[model samples]
Target: MKKPSLTILGCHSSIPTDKFYPTAQILEMKGDSFLIDCGEGTQVQLRKAKIKFNKIAHIFISHLHGDHFFGLIGLLSTFHLLGREKSVNIYAPKGLKEIIDTHFKWSYTRLKYCIDHIELSSKKLEKIMENEKIEVYTIPLKHRIYTNGFLFKEKPSNRKLNMKEIKKIPDIKIVDYKNLKLGKDFMTKKGKIIPNYQLTFDPPKILSYAFCSDTSYHSPIIEHIKSVDLLYHESTFLKEEKNRAINTGHSTANEAACIAKKAKVKKLLLGHFSNRFPNIKAFEKEAKEIFFNVEASEPLKTYYLDY
Candidate 1:
């Protein structure tokens, strides 16, 4: 089974201040890095976090809010300047291509790498793209605008052979073992097909990751984001400012925690804090009241989810 790693590039809500950047995150699947929400200073944050730029083959933007996508143009331009030749796919909402073209056309900078853009939305929780290793889809979110969240799920892999068991089974062809690992019964030259059940264990189920940003309190989200390995949800304010959060289409720490708890995620990461609160501890304290596994994130910090 492949273990996934996640890095928090920026988590503060409204603005980039004292020690925070904005709202960017990086997920490492196998060896591929998938970036979620490239807020301002994402590249710098990646550099500080020691994330390899080239490994970031895909970018999934949560919303068009400046705090989420403002740094995209710059990052694309930087890729060109740095001589990136591989193509990068970006899964984002509509008008992204237009905005990217506007920036490139205005700045008169050409990208050296090909960029494949997939338009996304909440209404359509469709699979944007997939490969042998990972599958990505959009999850509708209730942000202030036409926003959408993302769900990243790793594909199930072949089960490993129980070497000890295989050793005891004499005359079992390695080819038969390979077939069993692939869930196929293989017939030996003599005649009998080896049963997969006797030879190999079932590969573990696929693991999932979900991201929800700038959304107000909502319950349906728990259904879509159910039982994920990791969940990053926006917590722009504390319960004291719940009214303001509702008015602004943002979620408070307690609200975010509630969603996480309902989803039964392995871990709940709270971010996008309101600039009004310089004290980050308040958000953590408030969220812990509802979610036991909840925790605050720091910019450029990475966490590995191994199960």
Candidate 2:
């Protein structure tokens, strides 16, 4: 399996600091890349990280918060300046289309490429995109506005054919091999039935990654993102700021850990840190106390999801 990797461009909350920007990340899986949230200076971070700007064809925005989508116009303008022709698909909430349209109208900017805006609703869980390579779903989150987290799941590949076992059956033709690999029973020329289980081995386990940003401690999300290989949850506050976290519709490190533990995720990536905290060690320590597999996200760091 080609491992899915996450590269964090920005993970801070509200605004961009000298060190940390807001919530932007690139998830590369099966040779396709997705940009999750385009905060201010995301293009700069992407350039600094040495990632190609055109490689990311899809962008998923969690909410309309400035920290989450302020850089979108700049990125689009840059794409226009670079003379890009490929269409970019943007999956965001309902008002984003109008926002982008207004920005372009006011700035008299015409994009060189097509921008396909797919609006998301926070009412329920829905499958946003599915192809042979990957599947993406929306996870409704509790926030100040209509927000959604995304779940990226890899599609299961065909079962591997057992060559030695197939060789034993001389009547097994190329067509029969295809059937066997598809988990179908094969019939030999001698009229003998070969079970699919005997002709093929199970395929590699499907991998999944969930991105939860700017959400409060909401229990319903646990079900949607259950058993994901890697989970990125916002941990905007420490335990001491629990009240602040609640008031701001954000999660504490401990709360993020609790969600990861309940969802049975293999690993938890904590991000969207508040600027008030200089040291992220406290966040890691607090989450590790509840869930040992938790790690804090660092800007420009790539984390591979190994199942």
Q: Rate the local accuracy (lDDT) of all candidates.
A: 0.84, 0.92
Q: What is the TM-score of each candidate against the true structure?
A: 0.93, 0.96
Residue-wise lDDT of candidate 2 within 204-239, one digit each (tens)?
888899999989999999999999999999999999
Best by the TM-score measure: 2
Candidate RMSDs in order: 2.0, 1.3
Cα lDDT tens digits for candidate 1, 36-100: 88888888988988977888789988878899988888888888888999999998888898999
Question: Residue 173 deviation, candidate 1, in Å?
Answer: 1.0
For model 2, give the RMSD to the true fold. 1.3
Worst 10 residues of 2 by lDDT: 172-181
Candidate 1 lDDT score at position 293: 84
Steric clash pairs (candidate 1): 13-272, 13-273, 122-140
